[model samples]
Target chain A: MKTNKTSRAAQAFEKSLAARPTGRYVLRLFVAGATARSRQAVLRVRQLCEAELKDNCTLEVIDIYQQPNLARDNQIVATPTLIKEFPRPVRRFIGNLANITGLFVELDLGAKGKIAV
Target chain B: MKNNRPKSTSPVVHLPKCPTGIQGLDEITGGGLPRGRPTLVCGGAGCGKTLLAVEFLVRGAVQFGEPGVFMAFEETEAELKANVASLGFDLAGLVQRKKIVIDYVHIERSEVQESGEYDLEGLFVRLNHAIDSTGAKRVVLDTLEALFASLPNEAILRAELRRLFRWLKDKGVTAVITAERGRDQLTRHGLEEYVSDCVILLEHRVYDQIATRNLRVVKYRGALHGTNEFPFLIGDEGISVLPITSLGLNHKISSERIATGIPRLDAMLGGRGFFRGSSILLTGTPGTGKTIVAANFAQAACRRGERTLFFSFEESPNQIIRNMHSIGLRLEPLVKRGLLRFHAARPSLYGLEMHLATMFKEIVTFQPDVVVMDPITSLMDAGTASECRAMVTRLVDYLKAGQVTSLFTSLTQGGHALQQSEASMSSLMDAWLLLQDYEGNGERNRVLYVLKARGMAHSNQIREFLISDHGIDVVDAYIGASGVLTGSARAAQAALEKAAVLASQQEAAQLKREVERKRAALERQISGLRSDYETEAMELRRIAEQVGTRTFVLGTERAASGILRQADAKVAVGTRGKPGHGRRN
Candidate 1:
């Protein structure tokens, strides 16, 4: 449950260092329904995460339409959803996965899905 | 609309009912088309669909004694009746006479829906009742677009429509069905697909920013129709198609060439005359005397003690007569004598078919020996290409069959006078005449040319015709210093050419004067040298005796005349040029 909060916080960071092996903590988000409003939200989230995480963050995005059943196990409800999978406990966020400022305050930073501070 | 599949036993053959003979319309439709056959009249906005329907019913009663039924899907009966009051249709009178039955159906199709196997029995019952009551031989469906949204499932409605058409055919009546046209195709939502016995499309297109109503007949199941698009007009007489193509029909041969009250025009047609009962086309640019020519035709017809019907699409009869009077057509007496009938209407008043029908009926009723429509292009708004063509062809054929002489005046585009009128309409007439504004001498002059006259020995000469107080009369072929004179351009051209020729001649004269002046100076110098040489010789002889020397050559003498005698003068002045060179040595 703490990992969920950390992943949420991680989403606020516009860029992640998760791609790097040394500081790698890869976070992936999957969304359904690439509608105008949902796409707008994704754009905001992507911007905020990149701006906050700086050089040590990595984020990968995949649409649910590309793989549907994966979303069911993830318990996705609303469209424009975001999932923080990989590196410990997975976390999911429903609604507009936007609000970079509030999201960065709750996401994790390590393999244990906790803030590195 | 070819209802019969190969297996079907007998296709119901419905004889096209003639819409009430409206002057120009009955001529185009070849006797009003099959009664209740649902001839679709379609066009874009303001293409005169409603007016055409009204005209057909009104004229049916007035002219043909055939009562009519008009079902309105677009407007109220009162509204349509009011709209066409100015067209001289007298719809209210017809209704009162029980000659016309009008049912204005205002139900919105969008709100009405038939979920199951609902039949249009109510509409048919109402229509049949109206038809039976009025004894209408002609039926008009104002528009089909509004009915579509009112009835759900177009496929079913289409089937119902098919049944309705079959019913009309079984009843043996002629029908004029109006359809709203989509922006892209001929009819909205392909209503044409279902009703296809004869499709007349009215087109209002902006070419060079001028909106013209053109009627085209896309398909005619059983009859030969005019294939070219014809122009139509709407006015007090309703829609009038202008194409008077005289196809293969026996025309009354009148050897008498009634002079176009204008001597200029009559002379242009021929010194003897135009074929007595032939159709004439007066075509020219605006203000180039097209109306004047039409008036000439009218006056000539009236003068021969023959009745003439003049249909003016753009101007009122009074205005036409007034204006023509100024240019020189005296028609007030003709109107009083009932020898001339002048009808004016806007081209947007009715669809092309209706306009033509009204014209034909009017012509037939008047029993006019001659007919004229001024600026026929104004009527092009009534229908699309195919309808106008069929209607015009029918009109000309009808006229020819009746042996009634006809003439149409077409307003031509600038510089393309002959082309706009003669080329397109020549095939439809026995004689095609062109009125043009030719530029010469910095002025525009009206020149007339006869392009083609079938079955007549017509003059190939372009004649000079002028309009004065009396009427139109041909003077002679204007043989000026330049080409021809017609209106401002041809007159100006002649002036310019004459000026150019004069300028060239002046230049040559100036050159000749300069050469003569130079030659005179040379002659004066030679004469002066001869006198100077004599004086010098006298002095030289006296000097040589004093000097006692052998004769010296003029090269060393260095006298004033020596320059004159330097070459040719040396031989000539040596005492009659003694031995030429030997004497000189």
Candidate 2:
């Protein structure tokens, strides 16, 4: 499980590196430890950054258990909280990132073609 | 911790407690909130729930030397600091000193979207980090119910909250969690369900347009606590809860006596005065000089270099000073000297509890040796009769505990009701002086007498209470066949008595003069009779001489006076001898 987490973290880092600098969306996902829900939220946000907003998003996932100070500084109350840091306006999404359309609409991302589940 | 246990038949395992350092709060909670556990403090909006939580943390940090972490869900750090600063809490200073750490948890529902299962591990992490950074032994989550409004999933929130409480318990830091009062439950979000070791409910109630804040401990899992609603107020320092019946009757008493300002009045009261550290009740009818008596007592106390505090419910401080000045009581000088303080407020200014709290505050701040409440009956109008009695009882108990002498003036309507109204309060007093009005002989007079004086031989004679420019003077009221006479009637009676004495004195003098004249006349008459008797004796002597000469001439004149005298003597001797012989025969 530890190796899998490291590999996923590396993939997300590569994806953010490949994203273009211009009009890039800066995002941070706050999750608790290595729970399945945290893993799902991490995977979902990374997939959205890669599939929908390709080469235009930088996503960083932080485990509150590992970096509790950051959680305190950001006032993170719920786990799996996704924060849009660099967009013109800061926004936050709590809970697992399950509904893609709803997330896209709330993030002010223009309505795009529906992606297959 | 073991010393805090009650000596009862229950098991001896005592619950450890963390002192809140709030006045009168620790006594009510038996020590304080259950230690190393989350206690729920629920109240309605603007009911001082947040302030209580903040005070708990601040007191813990500052007074108990226990570093605290305040995690505010409703207010930010700046806002909380500004809010508590009004109560004189130096939040910024505490924060800078590393004694307290404030973590403002901001969760905006409109700016967030919930998609799936979530836990409050983030909160746990933040709380843990804040506590660890400051090495805090105390934590406060002010109004954690804000999460219920921010989080959409109740099932997940409840589970996370439960786990969060369990985690906090395991962490072993005493925590205070504030929640909004619910309609049918202890908290709006049922936060009490999880943080159930102790629950404190704060209520703000209005009676007769006056508001009173009350606090009650609803439950304590393994401890004994006060279940009655105690009145609490947010004073300049912080929140102070007043436990009505907590003060026991085991105060050290003083045997020293203090004089009433009126010398004669003091004479009426055991010749010395009221016992030190005793509760004195002064009851009177309207315009019967109750305030004057109270002022006298206060002045006497001040003169003795004792700090005196006078609470006037009907008059302002300036008015009392001016009025007392008219009666020759110069309280201003004593006040300037700081030995006397006058606190005046209308009875209707606030609720009875508020007045009591203010009085307690004043007594504490001044630490006066003597406290005088001028016309305490006016305060009865602010609350029920029973409430007034309870207030008096608590006040007396408090004053006694501090070894303070208290004098309470009660205004009676008049007539027989005078004793009836003060019957309830008089029992708590060590000395009770009653001032009454006597209306007769076309005048009204004030009379004073000691009705009761415990542990002292007090006078039962009613004295005519006189208030003049020189102050109070108690004189004996005239008790004659016409009943008790006062005012002009007493003076008239005195005058009549004087006149009767004078008339009797004059008649005795006149009879003495007549006896002197009669004796003088009798002496003159005796002198006249003596002169007449002397003249008659002289004439008799001359006649005898002539008779002797004539008898001598007639008996050949002479040989005469002697011969005539011899013959006469012989005749007289013969007559006497014949009379004696006849008597003998």
Candidate 3:
């Protein structure tokens, strides 16, 4: 019964992601030096998507030292910059994720859960 | 038609860094400083160096909703918040919201030792980190000049200023770096040498027995701004600049004339009345019944069903109305009828511009056909002579544009109330009415005189009037041995004249007849002032129509068609409801 439930959840997530024309909308947070603030921000975003979004949103975390070129391409001015990739008008919000409302507004992830799972 | 295109400074497109919305700062800068460059705000101790810088940052964060960074050189986080809470700004809330980033760098000058040539790299890094962290578009360097005192080397200080300004410019953040301005031009440390964008000088001067705060824009590189010495006042609302004078001699105006409400006054302009939007100044010393005269005019308009607004800076509405009532002019009925509105407030509530702005706002909101300022001199407490002049001049122009008839009362000093010195206000007034008190022969008499009425026939000769429980009454004066008689002295003088006349013989009959004829001519002039008051008043707007201002030297007038109409109207209105009809309408 547990295996069946896990497979069912995976199938639901995969179906929603595949239905989108761009496959899925992804937000990548590229952080440098892994500051406690940055790590907390990543965990906060992940939990916010799970408890808030449930599974409709997808968040990807990146260490800039692992890929310096990605940081440059996205014009990351500082640590912990969240890049909204799927939206036609791309925007970046840089902070330690202190303002959740500002982050949520910029990322376009409201309670309606418009982002692909 | 001019095509205004931005002259491209660089290939990079610039986003408008949110406006600070401070009053004088915007006006002096032609709209605000260069969008993202660090403009240094410098001044001496107790000269508002810190407050202004903080105000700039706070205004950006709160008023304009722009994220800002305040790098304090002296104040702590708690101290800064406590200091600004008095201004009704929630500085702590803004900090908690992450909309503002304040870094209090406490570095004592004596403790820091620099062994080698070093730039302000660490400070720049921290500032850049703050800016990058919050995406702040506005920055304030409160007293960066203190660092010069802290750091021993002059070369490093100057270099650091250049580098810091350049970095702020490159990041495209509008920054303000406060410093201590020196007696010489530019800052003491010559930061003005590094930043070639803008420099403003704030100064306080006491001249002609008045402490006037003035703002002088020493330079603004890429903008056109008012280069004159602007009178500024710092109060609860911060600094406000006085109105700008129209150096241009021409402004298109409406040729309409409206009634001053007082029939006799309207007659002074000829039967046609005053130009719809002209400003009439009623000047007199204290207790000369200027308020009573203005109330009479306003009440008349209210009786006529036209909206009238009374701005009393000297007296409250109830006080003014009650005082006028003591003299028998019932202003309460007019106020109750909803045609008259009085707005009373202290002049100190705002600076001159704000006062004018408030007046203009009320005027616009009420849309009154006639406006009255009970004592225009009340503005003396809020601003300097030049500022008051500019404000009054703007008010006149604005009223004329809107076609609202306005009356202004000024309190003049010294013994001469009839021809009181109106050097600061005379030029803007279309009609000048002088009220005075004359004491001679053991009695004090109040005399009312119209010195100058532009474009109208007026009574140049002073007239006698009485104030009683029944209001103002125009009566015959006792022409005694010398001075004009009024009130009780006039009564005694009249008795003496009658007694003397009863004793006169027939030999002086011809001389009396000649004098009577001349007196009749003067009476005819007065009557003509009433008769043509309306008709000639219609044509009396010599203000703009004249080729140039032909200064009417004293009391002389050319009788016109409406002058007779005005005389008849006054005789009719003055006796309209009187117990016994005094004159033939």
Predicted model with the maximum lDDT? 2
| Worst 10-residue lDDT window, candidate 3 chain B | B553-562
Point out where model 2 deviates above 4 Å: A1-22, A85-90, A107-112, B3-11, B244-246, B316-318, B345-367, B381-383, B509-585
Report the CAPRI category for model 2.
medium
Candidate 2 per-residue lDDT, tens place, B76-136, comes to 8999899899999999999999999999898878777777777888988899988898999
- The positional error of residue B363 in candidate 2, measured at the CA in angstroms, is 4.0
How well does candidate 1 score on lDDT at residue B267? 51
Count of clashes in candidate 1: 135
List the candidate numbers ranked by TM-score, top first.
2, 3, 1
Give the per-residue lDDT of model 1 (tens digit) for B1-585: 223446556766544446545544555666556555667888878987777777777777887788888887777878977878877767888788888888766543222222123334445655766787777888887776666766555776677778877888788678888887877777777756456588887877764334567677777778666766777767555776666563556655666666666554445455556666667766777777788777776787788898999888998998987987786567898899999998887877766655776787798789988888886767656554445456656776777677677887877778644484446565777777777666656666666777787766667777766667766656455466655545555446668889999999999999999999999999999999999999999999999785654334433443334455675565546554445435455
Report fnat for all candidates as fractions from 0 to 1: 0.00, 0.85, 0.00
Residue pairs with backbone overlap in model 2: B552-B557, B552-B558, B553-B557
DockQ for candidate 1, C-alpha atoms: 0.00
Off by over 4 Å in 3: A1-117, B1-20, B46-66, B78-99, B108-117, B192-196, B206-211, B234-239, B246-261, B304-319, B332-370, B378-384, B398-403, B414-420, B438-440, B476-585
Q: Residue B549 of model 3: what lDDT?
A: 40
**TM-scores for all predictions:** 0.42, 0.84, 0.61
* True-vs-predicted CA distance for residue B45, candidate 1, Å: 14
Candidate 2, what DockQ? 0.55
